[model samples]
Target: MPVLIPTLVFRPVSTQLLVTDGVRSVGENIRDALRTHQDTKTLGCHVHEPIRPYWPEDAAAQSDRIFTGRYNGRRFALNVTGGTTLMALGARRAAAEHNVPLLYVDTDNGVIITLAPDGSVTGEREITVSVPTSTYLAAHSATVSAREPWGKAIERRESWLKPFLEAATVLGQAGGGSERLLDVIRPVCSGGAAGPAELPEVTTAEESLANRLQEFGMIEVARRGGSLQVQPKGDERIRQFLTGHWLELYVYRACLTSGLFDDVCLSVDIRRRTESGTVVNECDVLTTLRGRLAVISCKTARLDHKDENKGAVYELDSLLQAELMGLYARKVLVTNRLALRPPLRNRAGLSQIECIWGPHLPDVAQRIQSCLLPGRR
Candidate 1:
């Protein structure tokens, strides 16, 4: 928890890094990342020339040189939190030689701690700076290729989308084969893309749900005795919403209105270049809170503990690892199910991922706030 640097007027040694790198490519990426960080450009940060050193001895020498050779007489502080042990040792030696202050970010409490020349706590200040999703991903060595904004059109439709979600809750609890029907209907709505479809046989629950959806203008349905044929409304976005995107929009709205998150993005596509090849990931809903990444995966479809939902469970768990959002990320899997099956809940629990169901989604923001600020009520 020693990597978050907030840009504050009164702080330890002003915010910036004299980046150290064993690999020049990685060092350049770091510099680029900081240069493009949300606040770095506007608020300003001091970016020193990169120090390339492979060995501890070299690390100490070059790090010292960065301060002494060029910027003599200017006050300096050494930050040793992010780099390797060898680098930290080198940095410590350099700090001692120059008699400069040392500092590291305290990620756990979202604070920065500065050490005096004696290594005692000189000052610690809370970090109130916010980082966007792109900056967060870049810190983990990923780049955002593309992302979809939460549109104003969607905002205008929130009131219109409410009834269908309410009906979703009621029909979700209905007995009979409604879940299977929903699985079919969603694809049909997506596949048709505002076109007509002859739906498969639906039960009383499904028929009721479909009819309610039709009344909500989600689709157009004509009843022919026992069979049902459907057509989506003209709007493609609305069709997408009817096909499980509603959950994502609802969750996004919850976070936005909550005013707790630093940044929230929907449908974010990320790319990370690796030695093997280019790696890619897409987040349904991505956010940063309390100096930690939080990824929320939304599901309007039914989920049960049995291997049926195992892929979804593991995919969400995977996002919490270093390959993606990093181990420090807060992971949450959200579902329209009023309550998930016990085993599924336990599976998510093993990864410490919080699951929010339809009934409790009204408080999703509160739940996120609680996770980010666990000490608070």
Candidate 2:
């Protein structure tokens, strides 16, 4: 049998590591990760250590050592699923030197990629690995306890929000008619206030539009004294549907519809300890494609703030968090606002973040697909 050599890296999950057929690991972290996930049960597990992952020479030396001894005569394939860039570079050198094939798992596209010894793409073969959601979440260090199954949650939300989202789009376009109705209901839906005593009188034309919103089950009209009372459904679902969470759900649905990702997580709560204390970072959406990570931040509110520096600061902080996830992970901001001020845009450019906004919001799946195309990022 051909021997598979893989470099080890720090990972919260072992989906990628387990899916790739290999025996190579250069660190205790990866070895433990694989063992905890039970990947070592089916795949060959070879653990070696004391090699520097960030030094190309050290990584290359480790690869050389693995190739020596009893394993010398077997054909070798380098699987660069884990490890640092230095380790990848060193492994690439080793592969080229031995004229062996290089393999990589593209998690996003669910494909096994083959590269010639010279680092040229040779082929891509699709794969199906049965990885449970709980296993995947555990690998990523996410708190799976008390968390709803993402697929079930998504299915429930999609059914509940379909008509609500359609109404929102119409309200977005209908201007004052929509605005007035929202004003009458916002207090009831957002705050714990009772329904408004009376809605502002509407023109005959606007009255029909208001009736349509009621017909859509977005609100209920009741008579109070000598006037019409407007009461929006104040359930938690409605509150979330009306807020930024709606946009987050929209983006998540779009990603699901596109079918371009290997795995997707919505509202992933990641906790990490800092010098001060433990902090929780909630990502709107996290996706893996073609073995790269994509961190998407969805904003329904305006991107521009009166305080010029505020928006830039927020985007910068988000970008920094994405960088911490992985070196080559894509950082993206998706917003329904028309545009961000030039400063914020410039900051995004400087940080290598892809901003999708305005009209592009409707075509989010296509836009994200474009970003994931080979040679784009």
Candidate 3:
């Protein structure tokens, strides 16, 4: 009997019944994202969709039909966290009838609350599942194209990365020099570098910008009397950075070095196709912290109209749309070399957007890191 033996290991199978509504792709996208999740893939478990967007009575009936059909014997839990109020009401009816546990997600606090089948709170559970950036986007029915060249090089280019951060610091400390420099140099460097004869005469603030970058070895500058000359060094990337690309890199590098985020992307192009046409949303920096989505917008040039910063504020606030990234996303607007006055701050605050401006922008990396330490959060 001890000569030979055969063994088998069987893991429990987990299944989910997703409830969607007539709203849009919100429910479909969530189901699709979950179907593509790492666990469901590895375990070879299948995702089945039997219920579609329907009225309250139809929704409850469909749920009941499925429960009494093939999945009758399987243990179940109902998540009433999302979907339309009617859909939730129908799901609640089915849950009560089927005697399944109910759940509500507390997104801000990062926990899932359990409830009795009748819908009263029972207890809370931590969010254990991990969601990737792509999955998060897919959950919102948005897809991300390839990232910019700067993104691929973020973690690999420490030598260049360090200097860029240092230069950004100098930009903030140099008073209004950073903006003047970006505004002037961006156009000159964008379509290839312009001839020296075509360079604009430097204003006092602009001249300070040129001088500070010179000290950081980013460029060589010569001033004769009141005339200013800028000789950009290094590769074409250097010129690209001067053309408002540096601010993106600055904010990205700060997030990357903070080590607080699990995934960091720089200059992501988000596209969503609709009946009208394809819409594009260009983001400066996109990251995820504890499975939550964050969109950071960087501004090197003034985008205000009539000295009102509402233009920039609205652009950042638009990410909350359901067709875009959704309301759960964290929005941040970081301005380099320019101070965000009280009006801008108050406007951003109203939208729950974090505004990091001027010199304060330079300390973001440290701030994020500090929150990671024990008792700091």
The local distance difference test score of each candidate is: 0.65, 0.56, 0.63
What's the CA error at residue 330 for candidate 2, in Å?
1.9
State which candidate, 1 or 3, has the greater lDDT. Answer: 1
User: Lowest summed-lDDT stretch of 10 residues in model 3?
Assistant: 1-10
Q: Write candidate 2's Cα lDDT for 81-162 as tens digits.
A: 6567787898778767767687886644546788998989999876443332233333343332212433346546646556
**Candidate 1 residue lDDT tens string, 1-377:** 24435333233333445565444444445445565664454443455556654457766876677667556777777777776777677777887888988777767666778898667888887766676777767766787643443333343454654564454444434422344545556766666433456556656766777787777777777776776777767677666766677667667767876799988776666787778998777778777765677788888766763775787788777656754455457888877675688888888888787887756776777777677662321
Pairs in steric clash, model 3:
none
Candidate 3 regions off by >4 Å? 1-21, 42-56, 152-217, 222-230, 303-310, 346-352, 365-377
Across 1-377, the per-residue lDDT of candidate 3 in tens digits comes to 00000000112253344444343455456555545555443432233444565567766886687678766888766666555678678878998999987777765555667899988899976643445566677667677754556654663564665676677656645534466556655655665557342235667877777777888776777776667777776567777677667777776767777667756778777876566997888887777654466677777776454354787788877766644666456777777746666777778888777767676766765544333222221
Misplaced by over 4 Å in model 2 are 1-41, 45-47, 52-61, 70-72, 79-152, 155-188, 192-213, 220-231, 272-279, 306-316, 319-323
Clash-forming residue pairs, model 2? 12-139, 12-140, 13-139, 107-291, 108-289, 108-290
Q: After best superposition, candidate 2 residue 36: deviation in angstroms?
A: 9.1
How many clashing residue pairs, candidate 1? 0
